[model samples]
Target chain A: MAIEVRIPTILRSYTGGAKVVEGSGDTLNDLLTDLDSRHAGLRGRLVTEAGALHRFVNVYVNDEDVRFLGALDAKLSDGDSVTILPAVAGGAFGFAAAAAIAQHNTAAGRRTPVTVG
Target chain B: MLSIDRSIVDAIVAHARRDHPDEACGVVAGPVGSDQPTRHIPMDNAARSMTFYEFDSMEQLRVWREMDDRDEEPIVIYHSHTATEAYPSRTDVSFAGEPGAHYLLVSTREPDTEEIRSFRIVDGVVTEEPVRILDAGVDPHAVQSYMFGQSPATVDYECSGR
Candidate 1:
């Protein structure tokens, strides 16, 4: 059976304004190759030279992460839905200190002492 | 009808603010339908740009197991935005791992000024919903009153180190 891949707005231009596309495949790798063939610049976004799924690209098979399963080679069955979620990370400020303090307070033996000033 | 204890939202916001500049991620767990706070699965993600968040695989898996052990599914997957609009970006929309998951984004860019928004992202569609605000009342961490076990989330590494 064929699966439907929905394209995000940012990448729609590459798909010629077609957000949702149909293709037939039994695995993520095959589906992705077909998608890249039909649309340019798509493959480069997913895999790197080592043939590993670029860490930036996250794929989900029927809402379950393929990364947790088998990455690109993750198997897909007929009618099974697959989602491609490339890790999108871009922003101005970094949330480092706040995360650290929160963790410290939560860690074993590291209590956040109450302070009054 | 979807009631989330205001305290969980506040604590998540505060935590995000504390990590201003980089991205902060966490998991919100409840009874799938409850008024009281459930659990918070704190995690780390490497910041790439102004509007994208990539979580650590090990951390995410660990939290997933933790949530499973508690017999609760992750109801909300949260992250922070440092410079972009609270609205989900094309990138965020493209890779919505959860079709029925509540996607919450807290903009810590306006550090002193807090702006937090919650969204329901499904199949590339992002819908903004009203998040019932809870009064901070007596405790600064008051919202965290019903917090589950503290999993101790720490940033193993960051690019900017901010």
Candidate 2:
């Protein structure tokens, strides 16, 4: 079962700058494992140490997000197109800082921290 | 350095202003390997939070696929900071995944003046870069300070309310 995977710009290095690469597998995990064989360290970026999909990495089987389709356990078939995209997210403050500030503000009985102008 | 059109910068600033309490995010796509930013695609902030911004997953997929089909890449990834300075915060540094694209930040903290800055974030390292905004229809090589010197009588581009 050959599946075509689209690589994002950030992960292109692992695929030798190729935009698309092919791999084989019956499930998403197996597909990543198959890809890791050819693209060393690629799986590490997509999957965390606990074997779960990285929080900031988004994987889609065709047009559907894999998270909605059993994530890493999602089934795969021949000619399936898998696309990997890094979740584009960030905030004005670090999580710890934001939490601390919120706690301090709450203790002071002040309104929530002003985030916007 | 991120050399982009002045109109595009205005559009970004306008979008940021319109979404004052919430951060606005978007991407500028250009031909592959060409650093020039030509298309401005304003994206929905899925988080819809005052301090954070995230591109909607489904919308991101569609936009990314469109860029891929057009043989283009995200040359500039921009977002607004509602109450902070126009600089990458620790959160931004940690979550930056587009090493090849310019990370443009617009600050709407001040009602009178908006601050804009650009940076290159790679491997958790943030390096500030100079932004050269080129005037529409003007030669890019010409040294014209459209942003600082004076405002154009008429804007050639319209900011889409996407």
Candidate 3:
């Protein structure tokens, strides 16, 4: 029931600089809990206070983004591999504009428009 | 200080110009632990906005995996400011998550001139750094001429909103 988790460089400090760590659980949430027990504060960086995945932290279960697979509830099995990557995002806009855009997108009930490249 | 190749700079500027009025974003990967930037990868700006840029999630995943397989890391994370100076905006600082990689900004506000600058944003603090462009035939490892100072070639312009 061992699942391998690949850590991004920015969060490696929590894992004693280990690029890959092993944990076990039936779901992504459980696995993160297991790892957090040893890593300390790592889970806080990936999950928000409301228990949802952080908007800027991307978690992929194997090849699929966990967002499309039930997020924290995403199922996991033995030997599953999870990769955590910090979202590479930004802009030249001011904070007020960003907040306005965010509100507009949320009100429209749509995620930021994305075009696959 | 960020020391990069002239060809790579040209490529980034070209990408920025081609995507004029829209933000362009990309990464330059180098060998693990090597600060030198060698591979230039132009990423799609998913947001595709005049003032914002975000990498396509799937493309980012694939590119990151390829960098991992090649034992490389993102030495430089770059983006263009279509209507502003080559500086990190509040949104840029809030979203900067990479502490080890240089955050490069290219300003295409002026049609005739391109302004480029680099910064290190750690813990929400942005610090500008010098850029040295290595000419072709020059050793990438050897020291080169410093092209820009902290402010770079940015022209004075009035920002409507803070």
Candidate 4:
């Protein structure tokens, strides 16, 4: 059950700059546990304290996304390859100001100020 | 290096222009293990933001499953930068999971100028590469390796009309 797990650049520090590492487990979660034992704190970045996979992390087994399979419980075996990547978010620009202004204008046009009845 | 048809490149740029003011993202799938990108798939940007792009989770699943059924894989993943240069941002590199895929960026910041670039993102490293746009009657397989000192694609590309 020696599976090859590819490490992402941001998380390679835990793996000592190793791009790929070998682990043994029947399930994906188990594989992470096996890897954490050797790598130390590798699993924390991928999984949350509540035991769920971290929201910003994506795990794939053999190129098939684990979320579509069974997430952390996805089955695994020897020769399977696991890849972990962080969720990409954020950039420049703002839609909030325009959206708020539009909403305000629409409200002002749709209703008139009424005195207390 | 990656070789793509001129028509395909045009289609990608067109999509970027059509989605101006909002980021666009999609993929070009090829036969599994072939590494020849041919199929064009324009996907909706889940974020719908000018500065960011995200593949809708459900749409991503459906597209991936469809590709799997067709014995294909995403050989090229593309996105648009509405106001930025055609380069992968830190977020893009952080999310790159396909080591064998070519990452393409198209910038539609200028109305008259569209800057398209290709990159290889593996393990968070972004390396720009030459994109050979094949003209009519020029086979991607037969095109001369115009990229100086760059290795040719591993698989030969045939006209696999969709």
The best candidate in terms of lDDT: 3
Looking at chain B only, the TM-scores across the models are: 0.74, 0.84, 0.85, 0.82
- Tell me the tens digit of each residue's lDDT in model 4 across B1-162: 788777566667767776777777788888888867777788777666667676765566567668767888788899988888777777677667677788888877777777777888877787888777776733454322222121222222322222
| Docking outcome class, model 2 | acceptable
Q: Which lDDT tens digits does candidate 1 get at residues B1-162?
A: 134555576567656765555566777765544433456655655432234456765455455545556666666778887776566666566556554457777766554555666677765666777665545423444233333322223311111111
Model 3 segments beyond 4 Å from truth? A94-96, A99-117, B137-162
Tell me the DockQ of each model, to 2 decimals: 0.12, 0.40, 0.43, 0.12
Q: Which prediction has the highest DockQ against the true structure?
A: 3
Ranking by lDDT: 3, 2, 4, 1
Residues A1-117 of candidate 3: C-alpha lDDT, one tens digit per residue: 599999998899999999999999999999999999999999999999999998777899999989999999999999999999988888888746765776687799876454322
lDDT of 1 by residue, A1-117 (tens): 688775644456668988577766777888888888889787776788888887555566666778777887788777876655435332233335434544554675554232211
Chain A of model 2, TM-score against the native?
0.79
Judged by lDDT relative to the true structure, which candidate is superior, 2 or 3?
3
Compared with the true structure, what per-residue lDDT tens digits does model 2 show for residues A31-86?
99999999999999999899999877789999999999999999999999999998
The better-scoring model by DockQ among 2 and 4 is 2
Candidates in order have lDDT scores of 0.59, 0.81, 0.83, 0.72
- Residue B22 displacement in candidate 3 (angstroms): 0.9
* Model 4 CA lDDT for position B55: 73
TM-scores for every predicted model: 0.52, 0.83, 0.85, 0.60
Summarize candidate 3's per-residue lDDT along B97-131 as a digit string, tens digits. Answer: 88999999999888877888889999899988888
